[model samples]
Target chain A: MSGRPIFTRPARLAAIVPYVWMLLLFLVPFGFVLKISLSQSALSQPPYLPTFAIAMDDAAWRAALGLLSVDSFRLLLTDNLYVLSYLRSLVVALVSTALLLAIGYPIAYGMARLPLRWQPVAMMLVIVPFWTSFLIRIYAWITILQHDGLLNQVLLALRIVAEPVVWLSTDSAMYLGMIYSYLPFMILPLYATLSKMDPALLEAANDLGASPRRAFWSITLPLSLPGVAAGWLLCFIPITGEFVIPDLLAGSESSMIGQTLWLEFFTNKDWPVASAIAIVLLLVLLTPLAIYNRLQRRQLEAR
Target chain B: MRANRLSPFNIICLTLGAAFLYLPIVILVIYSFNASRLVTVWGGWSLRWYQDLFNDSAMLAAAWMSLRVGVASATLATLLGTLAAVALARGEGFRGRGAFSGMLYAPLVMPEVITGLSLLLLFVAVNAERGFWTVTAAHTTLTMCFVAVAVQSRLSALDRGLEEAAMDLGCTPTRAFIAVTLTLIWPAIAAGWMLAFTLSLDDVVIASFATGPGSATLPIRIYSEVRLGVKPQINAVCTLIIALITVLIVTASLVSKLSRARGESAAPL
Candidate 1:
């Protein structure tokens, strides 16, 4: 403890380095985005031009602020296609999350209840999927879901359908891909929480003559809400901004906000428009996250 | 005790879930053996797609570029992450530690499209050239945060008493850390490195924005190809990647277990 007070040169440098690096690379880029959002789009060159402080007058500031008005919001809001896409994405994310929760919970619960000898094996199964490249997994879904693919072929041989159904380039296929990619995220945390739950509590509940379902609702569900919340947030947040799944599964017809944002930035090269879309999406996503955070804090404090 | 028996519902659910997770991968691998241009049709079982995949120069180049970027970015990220974890764990009274951690973790949750777009905007404004280096930089920036969090957790769980004992025996602080602290936390560092490597290899959204012509990563290449139509060769590539990852993970897990057993056995009772 005596030498701990002395400032070591290496210690001082290590403490400051990560923050400086993060600021320069991460935060500075974030600020640059915000700055570019306000600048006029360049016609001759790239999408953005640097506008010095002297160039930004009161009128310019007002115009920048005006871009955030109800009219722009309304334009985005009332566009039937945009609204439909948002709803479609929401439904897909919600349904996929539900499927993941349903599939993941039983596995987690079973793993948690198993003998210690089998625990590592069960955990390994959950983690092994993550080791493969994510894109490869999505590509695998294409092979399974495509016409004349494995699933369709099996169905056809069984005479379930005379021909292969067009499963790829559909919402259902996109949901399948999204859930497949994110199910592990849902399982791991749920398992962590469930494994930590005391067996005695369940035994006691059983002894009190409550049905298993009743005991589960009364004891297990509330106790595992933290993990549920965590799993949901993990799946939901990433799924909201999912571009690759929609791009691969639903093709050009999919109108996810992420794909829209991508087109704005890369294809259209409209930084301001893209920024506006991103800002809106961020605000919407952050609201639920903030609420969840607050609720989680309160839950922890109660404990 | 009676309830411990495997219920029919539980068995059904488990089987279906496992099939849902693994069948796609199995099918992809199987289709790769089909000798046909049409992905839907079964001409005959052959290794033609594997041959085709190996012969494809563009795909091969993309795979090589992805490997280079993943290795470089993961290495840089792990170093920075380990340093940051050391600071956070050992350095008390550091200014704005919470804020620093928040910024580090922020990108982990932030949408990839937003991150990619913002970084692209930054690059455009600075007139920075986009290519391999730019993609590596972007990946490093994102991967470092994940590595830092992983390392931080390991550091927090570590027992500091060993280092203190080493220092009391007249070793310098740096020597104490080298002897005790690092030895215990090396596995965590390795895990973080593996995670960072996989993430960099898998990344497509951000890579698409930052990568230039002839510098496409594996995911980007697969994505562009899939945009045209699915092919059996892509499935072949996916199967190979999955196999490689499975091998790496099993090796890492076995090594860690062996080291842990050795450590426990070496301990004096």
Candidate 2:
């Protein structure tokens, strides 16, 4: 083993740079955010003045800690608008993930079962949508969903509606935009996992007199849980902080946590409040992510 | 099962999925030729929007800026990522390797808003003026992780024997790597560069935060335009971008496949 190639001293030192860079650049800023979240909001001055003990006493330190109490949490909870937005973001993410799963599963399964030569072609088609600007893709939904847009034009031509429907600035339109944007994310992972499954198991199930639906539910679906989890996590986590879809499709009336955070940071210039909001958002978003990681580890262990 | 036989279900799925993915693009392309200002109107076909898009200096400038930044960022990212991938793949059991990999993966999983906001704060704290440099820095930071992962996968799948054999033939380690490992993994590095370029081109949220007025990217410009209101010229731009990407993807895939086939034929049996 000693005679074999291993990491050279220089190579190991080089490897340490990226981690140090990440810690200084990525992790430190996050730490700063957490620190700011715990500090008192400098409403009277700049957003983060870093208050000190007025009398240089222990009571001042205690008071500073007291000021940073769960007031932000209380404010976030009591504000029905913020609470509603949080819930709405979750619902949108969940619904979008489900819709993507529904649409992506059949397409992925079909792609996986296709002739080997055509599989790459199918994958290319799925990934081509990603090549364009993401904002442009969301903007494409605006063209399709706006009043007197292409969808309405077709519907009117078909005599399905006497007038154009107001689809944009609605939650349904937001949902459609998000699912359309993220469907490829769902499909790719599902396709990757499903394609790796043993074909013999499916054949064995079929040979044992299981119908197509039964075979899919019993064998294919269970095995593809990891893919489902991965796809769901990919779609759900990002959509929680989605600003563009809600902004374009649902308008300000359906403002999401991301939009709110954007406004707080940029428009209001309230750094402490924004930091507090961001900290809470991080917690809310990371809970599911942590849970997903735990589940993935368990799944691996079980295997 | 016969090779040529196709299931009806598979056929339907393929058709529907392709249609769903491509219809918006087709619509955008077709409507770029619409004579009327209203994109929904079925007016006589013309190339007015494309002409308008070309004549618009701001759009051209934004596109140029995006191209410059994208190329710069992708180049930097590919280099950094290649080094990191080598470390992660070939430096097995090295000190702090797991932590390095985790850090590499963190940005990919983190929400863009968090990344953008965090970077914005960092830039502010450091007194670094937000502009082209900041935007390029932000893009490189995110794109490097993607490049690393792509290159690492290729490196992991590579046969170690070729490099070992080359080294055994009295070549220096670095020389053997260049002659064997690098030649074999060049395709992956190229793929990672293309992926990074595309990602940089598509970035908006982070670019919005880091970009100054003079360094607005095409996506940032397009985003501001959409926020104001959609215009047919935007469709013309989207159409051009889609066409460019399709050409690139086809070219890259064909070239990579040919190179791999050649490599397989030349490999020692």
Top model number, lDDT? 2
lDDT of 2 by residue, A186-244 (tens): 99889988888887787898899999789889988999988898888878888888887
What's the CA RMSD for each of the models?
3.7, 3.6
Q: lDDT tens string, model 2, B1-269?
A: 11333579877987898888778767877877788998788688888888998899999999999989999999988988888887776765676665577667667656777778777767766668878888998898899888988888787777777777877888776787788888989989988888898899998888887877677899988988988776899988987877777787777798899998999899755
TM-score of 1: 0.90
The best candidate by TM-score is 2
Q: Residue B59 error for model 1, in Å?
A: 1.4
Give the poorly placed runs of model 1, Cα more than 4 Å off. Answer: A1-13, A53-87, A251-254, A291-303, B1-8, B43-45
lDDT of 1 by residue, A82-101 (tens): 56666766777788899889
* DockQ, every prediction: 0.48, 0.44
The best candidate in terms of DockQ: 1
User: Which regions of candidate 2 are displaced past 4 Å?
Assistant: A1-3, A7-11, A39-47, A51-74, A291-303, B1-6
- Compose the digit string of candidate 1's lDDT tens values, residues B1-269: 12344566656656676777777777777777888888767778988788888899999999899999999999999998888877766665467765676677667767798888778777766778899888998998899888887887777677676667777889888888888778878888888888898899889999998887778999898888888778888878877777777777877787778878876886552
Provide the clashing-pair count of each candidate structure.
Answer: 0, 0
The DockQ score of candidate 2 comes to: 0.44
